[model samples]
Target: MTAELEARIELAQAVERGASVLSSRVVEAFLNVPRHPFVPAFYRRDGAKYVPTRGHNDAWLRAVYADDVLVTEVGGVHVEDAPDCGVTGVATSSSTAPGLMAEMLDALDVRPADRVWEIGTGTGYNAALLCHLAGAATVTTVDRTARLVDAAQGRLHEVGFAPAVLRADGAGTPPAGGPFDRIIATCAVRRVPTAWLEQCVTGGVIVAPIGNALGGGAVVHLTKLPDGGGGGGGGGDGPIH
Candidate 1:
């Protein structure tokens, strides 16, 4: 690795260490998935270092390893295809930054062999991380964009990791996937979808960013109570910070 690359890695390690809310499995997943593959070529230079003329490669990598959210696509458009050099328009999808992801996972509390579902496949980066923690077969992810879904599928398979990926609306509930142990969304939702609450197992956790735009959003965590079917199950607080 180049000195810059080494520095980048060290930075990621430090962020992971400081992220007390993140779990070890989540940290490992952040370290394991290659953020370079999910990023556009312009943003990539030394594979691990950042190039400002290209994009914030180091910050993106740090976000990935920190389990935070990084916008990769916007307004149903992929970053590579967009004319703008840096992020532009509305962020429709992203490879969630590592720190935020870990925080979500730690809060969701997914365990080994637990069946988990993720909304917003994005670049499939988050799905890959989930597979690393929950096992490939135990994870299922859905995305609204067919192109994004296809691309994410290819990336995951290319890296020798596979999880059930589907093309679907982010707001819609998956088809009887299960009373999932945990459910997460890579995109922000204005409000918790009722369909998602129905699909979750009683007492299961559902995590997602609640609000519009990137800044001033709250990562809400909800627990499905035993009597959740009667509207008694869904209750939680927001802005995980």
Candidate 2:
């Protein structure tokens, strides 16, 4: 078997063991959507500096599918732009661990045609999974960073998915769109946004990490009710790290 496929299969097994119970569809999505395409390069901390890792070698491919968070941006600079000697900064964005991603996606309960709105487009890996679960045309993902949005859009398009990728604040109102069937946030928020609630259709699901959920290290999966109340269920505490 090819190295990528082998690594991904191993990752799938690890995710099933470490994260929440995944459905057949979720498993298929994990196996089908290769993580390396979305994260062309990532940072690995070497002492105080963050070194960039990029290549198509065996070790590189293994790390990409290792169920680990790949830090793509550090202090607003993409890893690809960093020097060989590396840079020192706080990680601004990353391709989250596959286990955490699987857990959240399983909680999202995406259907074939469900209209999905994703809060953080990060490496666009999660967005690609959403496209695999739902349809590409049914997904809309937004991120505040312009460069990240552009990179994500290009990577996603390269992989044959063309969801609506926007460079807008996830917490703010975008141009009239959605009464969406599902909304998922890959980023941490202090509280669930009122705009997100308003945009979701009644009975729609919102899977997000908010407030002490992360301190408790968990994600909340809420269903919108006709009365505009949410019926929440807790997903596994699969931390991004």
Best by lDDT: 2
Minimum summed lDDT over a 10-residue window in model 2 is located at 209-218
What are the RMSD figures for all models against the true structure?
A: 5.5, 2.2
> How does each model score on TM-score?
0.77, 0.93
Candidate lDDT (C-alpha), each: 0.66, 0.83
Candidate 1, 178: how far from true, in Å?
1.3
Model 1: lowest-lDDT 10 consecutive positions: 232-241
TM-score of model 1 vs. true structure: 0.77
Give candidate 1's error at residue 121 in angstroms: 0.6
- Name the top TM-score candidate: 2
Residue 179 displacement (Å), model 2: 0.6
Q: Model 2 Cα displacement at 6 (Å)?
A: 1.9
